[model samples]
Target: MKGVSTIQSFRVYKHGLKRLIQALGTEYVNLQNVYERLLVGIAPSHRIEAMIDDPFGELWREAQLLGRLRLRLWRSFKNFEDTVHDMREAVQEMMEKLGIGPDGEVEWIEHTSIRRQYKRVSFILQRSNYHDLLTRIREGVSSLQNMAIMNVNMESDRILRSQVRLNQLVNVTSNNIYHALRSTMTCRCQRLHEVGLRLTPPSRTIVPQDSDDDVIKELQFRLIISHMGPLATPSVRQWSEVLLQSARSQVREEPTTPLATKSSSSKKSVKFSVRSSVSSTNEFMQASAIIQPATATFSLGSAAMPVDSGMPQQIRDLCETMQTTEKRRSGDNCGHIQDHMSAKPSEYGVYFMDCLGDCENYVLVPLKDVLRDQSNGTLPPMLYSDKLRLAWVIACSVLQMQETPWIPSCPTHDDFYVVQKGGVPQYQNGFVLKHLPDRGGPGSTSTSTTSSARPTLLSLGIILIELILGQPLESLQPQDTPASQLSPSYEAANKFLGRVNMLGDLGISAPCNVVSVRYLKARTRRVS
Candidate 1:
């Protein structure tokens, strides 16, 4: 209700008081309201109006007021946003410093932060194009280095410089991203199994025995499969099957032949057919029935069987004693000591086979050394072929009696052609088996029984010659044996016995030219 001047003055005074409170106290003020407060501070005089009238002065005054208001608002939010940005940058820098992977992306493996937040940070980093960014950064660095070397004009270089700077910044940022990715990519898996991985071995420097390329390859396959991802190498299963089948083939024993004998071939085919048909059955039996008889025999000239001329007197003496006892007792008298002596059984015939190399085609043989098991414990025994048992010798031989007549026929008179003839020639080398009685004369009814028993025959004449002769059979005697049987002296017995059985089978023929004892001494010498 006062005059306009008086009302204005009072209003100005009220504005001044508000401005003072806003400046000195923690009161809030908006821009539009603050202008009145500023205007109130100005003296209500023509002097203030004169200053405002200057060029652009009114706009400047408004801007100043607006800026102050904006600054006040910005101050309130400053720490909240800046602190958040600083923490984010720190985390990103940490990720870059550590080398982890998805090669170029941040994997969760690297983090210094508390474990709980690592996965969360990694997820954010994954969305970043780490690889592309890093590539650009490297390109930018190259450009900067080139620009620095060229030193071009400012105007022209100015653009280049700006481009270089921008690229450098981009590159630096990208590098930081890449480093973060590398650190995070480190493997955090505690166990290989967790990742379905195996450990693959590196190549070895030394080779072991029997380690051929194929074998080494197979071993490598297995080792890699067990160590690395198991699914990566499946060749191991195929290799195992092949090795097993080869072992199975080696165990089958038969005379050496090119096509496995046709009969055996047929049998094998049949077995495969049967196996395919039923999957399981008596495969060996069915196969064996299909093969032809494995051996053959032939009859040569029927000669009179050899007689035991030396034992005739002993046999006669035993018969006489038995008769004398019966006569003295009239059927109840006991036999006298002489009668028992006459009845004493002679030791089984000790036949010899010519083992001399030249005498029987000089075939080399391999024999298994005998090992005796005793009740006390296993006695240490050396094998003939082993270095520890130098004194022992093992030899194998086969006797061909029909071809070599010097070999004497024994009680079991069946020819050896049935069991050995068709095999490899080496299998038919001369052998003298001992301890068989002489068979009865050919006309005897019991002769057939003796043939069924095992044959024990010898090339005793040829062996005696080797005993008498010091020279090897090949040089000193004929390959063929003498047709006529001759009685050998005790001197022959003393010869040809080194501690070892060099000529395993006695089919070895002795040289006819040497003295028996001399050959005997030679045989006694241990082979070095």
Candidate 2:
């Protein structure tokens, strides 16, 4: 009004002040109307003029702040969305390559035993692939964790930058608008007083103000929906790393002492004992070395050492009896103990298979050493049949005999098949399991009954079948047959001997080589 001419004021007074409003101070409008409209925030949407000629408009500053706020929010949301998408893709690829289920099941091997045997090179290639994929998976876990932290930091930086911008814009705009409003309003108030008129300010009704709180709540809601908790690495990978690291810790030196060293006279002979149990459910396949002079030998552990493993206790006892520092160290030895002997029960853990933690295989003693012992001169021609017969003898001696033919608690097989490191075989991941006593009935205990050597007869028959057919009784069963029909060792023994009995009566000669026939005849004469 001070800048406006008297004609303009008369025109404004006659018409209305709405058309003359511009920034904080207007050329043709009074500052009182502009201040009241901006502060109370009930202004009309229509602009007074086509352009904001002055830069000190409070309404314009509010709109600019809001627009920039919206753009910052949009950018933050987009960045979060992209991070989520990339993380999802990375996790998906990790799951596929690692062959792990969401529920933490590991694919033990993609190839079956037969497939690995037949396609050796292909299996090797797959193993290499698996190794690399495993390495990537481990690396990815660490990388993903770092990325989560990085994203959180970046998002925090973005919000802080936007906050700085908002503060800067708000500060400049507020100062300019405040000074302009004061200058213009003071002049108008003085003119109105000179005209003998009093300017009465309207009483603004104080309503409950919650706009700032509401804006903060909306931001919090957005943050909650876009949180990065879901981006954590899968638990399977975490548990698997635990297993891998645990296996690495189990690596130890193999015992290189021989089984038959004479001990010093000062040590007392400690008689070691065994716990025996037979299993009908498990089918054990001997290594090919079982039949050769390079027989299955033992080393203390393969990968894991039991905290209270009976193996160590028995080894101590063995050392006492032998009176030597090294007790029954495995390379090759006499065929004294055939079956594996453990104070507690044991199963053979697969080489790499168990390192992942499935851990459900049987263990064996160093009968290969005994076979090597037999391979020496002056021992009988324990060829294919003799080797098996000796195994049968050793199995019987370990089970029913209660004799300490083999003094060691754990048994082992030569891991010549495994890749050697620094010229020594890995043996800490090792143990020995003895042959189970042939059970008497469907629910019979592993302990042999006092009844006549009927178990021995049936076992001999099964052994005969094994030597003649060169296959397991279970393997000989008709394909597609239920295991229940041929269940338990007793049932197999009955079936095996029955067929052999018929073959003998029919003068079929029971299919034998000269050495086997001679050995059988001599043994039969001795028994009869």
Superposed model 1: Cα runs more than 4 Å off: 1-423, 426-442, 445-494, 497-528
List where candidate 2 sits over 4 angstroms from the true fold: 1-388, 391-460, 488-528
Separate clash counts for every candidate: 32, 23
Q: Cα lDDT for residue 75, model 2?
A: 34
Q: In candidate 2, what are the lDDT values of residues 434-483, reduced to their tens digit?
A: 22121234233223332332233334344444433334455567778886
Question: Relative to the true structure, how large is the alpha-carbon lDDT of every model?
Answer: 0.24, 0.27
Location of the lowest summed lDDT over 10 successive residues in candidate 1: 238-247
Local accuracy of candidate 1 as per-residue lDDT tens digits, 314-423: 12222122222212322121211111111221111111111121112322221111111111223233222331111110011112121112122331111111111122
Error of 2 at 364 (Å): 3.6
lDDT accuracy of residue 84 in candidate 2 = 29
In candidate 1 the C-alpha lDDT for residue 188 amounts to 27
